[model samples]
Target: MGQVHVVGPNRALLISGSGASGKQPRVIVGGRAFVPWIFQRADFLSLELRTIIIESKKSATAYGVMVSVTGVCQVKISGFRESNSGSGSPKLEKDVHAILLAGQHFIGAKKEEIEHSVASTMEGHQRSILGTLTVEELYKDRSAFSARVRELANEDLRLMGMELVSYTIATISDEEGYLDALGISQTESVKKVAQIGESVNRNEGRQRNAEEELKAQLKINEAKKKIEQSNRDVEVMQAKLKEEVNVANARADAAKLFEEAKLKQSIVEEETKQDVVRATVQVDVESEKVRRRRMELDASVRAQAEAELFKKLKEAEGIREFASAEAHRIKLIGEAEAEALRKKELVEVDMLRLKADAYKEYGQAALATRMIETMPEVARAIAAPLAKTEKIVFLGASGGSSSGPSALLSEVTKGAHIVNEGLQAITGVSLGEILKGDSSLNGLERLAMPIALNAVVANQGH
Candidate 1:
């Protein structure tokens, strides 16, 4: 019976002696494998990660400046193994070789031994990298320096059946104070730049504030100017409106006055028409009265003449009868008296006929002539009141003592003129033309004169 060797996840199992395959050992990772106790021996190589701290003191850089460096490296063994038939890809083949090497060298080795071997190799590579870089390069770009070290040590470690998982420079320092002096210089330069930038920013802020203020002030001034112009426009508009209102009022007043004047003129014209109508009516009434009076006079005259004629004829007949009984001389005397009476009767009848004819031909003109003849008496009657006054007191402005009488005479004359105009309007005759003997008289006045004289004579005889 063979013993079962159980392999852990982090370990590889190695079998040596007679049970191993050919010249190489049999490697197993994980699971169980059988080994004869007498002929074969099994060993485990840990596949867990290992950490190494490498330190170098007083290493000279490319500039001959001595520096000290402390670094950390992590390593692990590859778990790849070769198959039994040895048929695989080149990359797999390489990995198998690396795994076999790791098993050969580290099999049954202690953890400290593995760590020492790896640490020694990593330390040597770190020192070599340090010699090529300046102290500033090592400090400023530690990751780049670490990566260079890892790259350089990977091949060597793999050949030893180990792989470098990571490498980093933990600390780097120089024996001299050059790095300290450089830090001080850089800090001063940064402070100076910050102060200059702060001053420039503050100046720019002040300049922008001034420009904005100027723009705001200009806009305010423009607005104020516009406001003033608007106010002036309002004032001008108000003045124009006031003027228009005044013009309208004036026109209305003028129209009112014109309408009033037209109304007054129309009233006067109506009054004049009324007066003319009244005058015409009065003239007709007077003419009718005159005609009736003339007729009555004619009738009275005719009655008286007929009565006298009858009386005379009877007297003549009696005288003839008495004379026939007496002498012939007495009959001759009676005939003479009777003949004289008849001649007188004939003359009166002829006169009456002539008077009637005159009245008919010049009725209106005769009336006018009669009125004119009585005008002086009418004037005397009108002035009769003034003559009765014992004391004459003139009121108002007068030129002299004569002014009163003259003014009275002027008024009387104006009244006479008005009456004459009335007569002309009513009777179709102008008394003024008759008195002045103007040729404008229509020949009625000339005919009326003889009739007027005969009327006077006939009246006296009666």
Candidate 2:
């Protein structure tokens, strides 16, 4: 289908072509001819050589037979040639008859001449004439030998089939002095046309059968493709399902972990609550101990207060008793002092009587001097019983007892004395004054009588 340019005529027969290639070549060499162009390919040799050239009967009748009278034959065929058309082609059958009819005479020709003559002659395949030959004759006669070679070449052409074996000459020889050559064209060759038509019918029938087989194969392939696609879809769906299942499992695991964490948290909270309760209980115990201790301390304080009150009461009672005893002692001392005064008053009354009597007697000249002196001391004693009175006595001589022995009485009561010292200091003055008042000079009223008593008491004081 890809065209190429031809160079010249007859160039393919020149045997100078290069090797096959993908591009079609038009061969030319030595200024001779052009060869056919064909696209070169690796499988080009496998393409059917279907174009077989079969010449018409007109060409055979116009050319003449391919043999002579001595049984010589020639067959002419072209192995390869140029693709181009030309004029004035060679006359083939007349040339082979001329040489073979002079057969024994031609044997004397040189081997090179003989070989050249055979090479130059023609196509080599025939059947009916060449099969009947002697080996010695075939060797000795160029015509017989050529005929035998044609017969063997016939078998080679027959095996390829009717299409490939395009031309045949059954008997071309110089024995008939002329040969019969017939050509049947594909158009007018009834026997050949019938065979070609029969072949076309058989091939068409085979083609129809092959087409049915191809359709069946196509349906099978399409079904297999559908089946493969379904399998792929199933695999994809299965993979997606597996992924979903795994995700669900992971979620379940997470939920379980969450539950476990919650459980642990609850346990911890419960433990903390228990610890708090225990601490509260301990605090309550301590509080109870403090309360009991405070109650005991209050009771002890009350007992101590009671003891101190009792001690103070006893001390107050003892002080009252001591004060009462002191008061009683003072009252007794006053009573005794009153009694001594009363007794002293009675003694003074008696001394005054005695003094009056002595004075009377002395007035009548019947008493001694010693009686007056003793009489004064007795009066002082009487005054001591009543110590509040300040007395100076001027008693007349008749104020004493009427009859008394005062002289003897002075000697007998010489031990009687006044207790007061202040009264003794006035005794001398009293005696002097008494003598002066009593001057009736019958008896000696001495002025110095207090002096004699002074001498005696003064000596006693020493």
Candidate 3:
């Protein structure tokens, strides 16, 4: 390994050695390399190079004013040259100093030495171009000034195997302040124009605003006048409506009163008719009551007369029955009297016969038996008053004392007195006298007694 010379990708190799190349415009080499000789090793090199080109304070005159110009240039290798004989000087084509070895032939050179030569050459051209141009032309037309400088520098840069990529005038200054004075004059002129325009706009705006305010005021007055007229019209309409409503209300009230009066009159007439009808009905009711009472009285009188007739008929019926009964009783009494008289005659005949027969047979006993046969009739006559007696009271003792009267015995005595009273009434004979006088009677008197008894009974019968 003799000086390996491994070239980078951005570099080219200038192989000037005894192995394969002499000075054939720097045999461009990149990537890996091989060489058989050590003392003839080739140097590695780049294909492109960039360098800054700047110039300081170069003086130029314009309109008798002294101005200083400062400028910058960007430079790079653009081409290459090959000195095949490996003789003469290094001639530049694309000014690729990285491989060409600037200012020298058949020898290696540094990139800084080639770049310094480029800068010096560009500065000399820039200063020569500015010396003929004025400051006004350079400031106002920098593009034209820069073009002229590039045109002048391009030939020398090409000869050096370099090209100016870009150039700019960074600043231009003058000790007299010429640009500042020109800027001040132009800026004041623009300011005066803006001030004049602003003043005109202000006046126009004020005039338009005043016209708008006057037009608005006129519309306000017109609207106010119309509103006042409308209010007056509304007041007139309201007054008319109020008058109509009052008249209608008054007429309605009068009509209501008239209807009320008619209703009252109708009600009064109806009440009067009802009162008269009530009085008539009352009188009819009273008359109907009187008629009913009269009918009741006549019915009561007829019932009383009919009752009297029936009563009289019943009394007359009873009297007729009593009269018939009395007549029958009288007829029976006359027949019984006749029958008793006949029987008395028959008894007298029989007594005569019996007397004759008794003198021949029974003697006085037959006379006694004949007298006992009349004793029942005699007792019936005596007890006739007792048939009317409802109750009998014995006022005396149940039994009398031995020497005084006996109630039982008194009853027999009363029967005897009663029998004697009947015999005196019937035969005109006091049987008590016959019993009290105990004188014995001769046959003639005794016979006369029966005849006298018969005659008295018959005469009483008549």
TM-score of each: 0.44, 0.22, 0.36
Which candidate achieves the best TM-score against the true structure? 1
lDDT per residue, candidate 3, 422-447, as tens digits?
64687565544542322443222222
lDDT of 2 by residue, 18-37 (tens): 44332233222223333334
Worst 10-residue lDDT window for candidate 3 reads 443-452
Better of 1 and 3 by TM-score: 1
Model 1: colliding residue pairs: none
Q: Quick one: RMSD of model 3?
A: 43.4
- Per-residue lDDT for 147 in model 3? 88
Best by lDDT: 1
Give the alpha-carbon lDDT of every model.
Answer: 0.66, 0.38, 0.55
For 231-319, candidate 1 gives per-residue lDDT tens digits of 98999999999999999999999999978866754554454445434544554554454334434433443366535534433443343
- lDDT for model 2 comes to 0.38
Ranking by TM-score: 1, 3, 2
Model 2 deviation from the true structure expressed as Cα RMSD, one decimal place: 47.0
Q: Which ten residues in a row have the lowest lDDT in candidate 2?
A: 41-50
Q: Number of clashing residue pairs in every model?
A: 0, 17, 5
Clashes of 3: 5
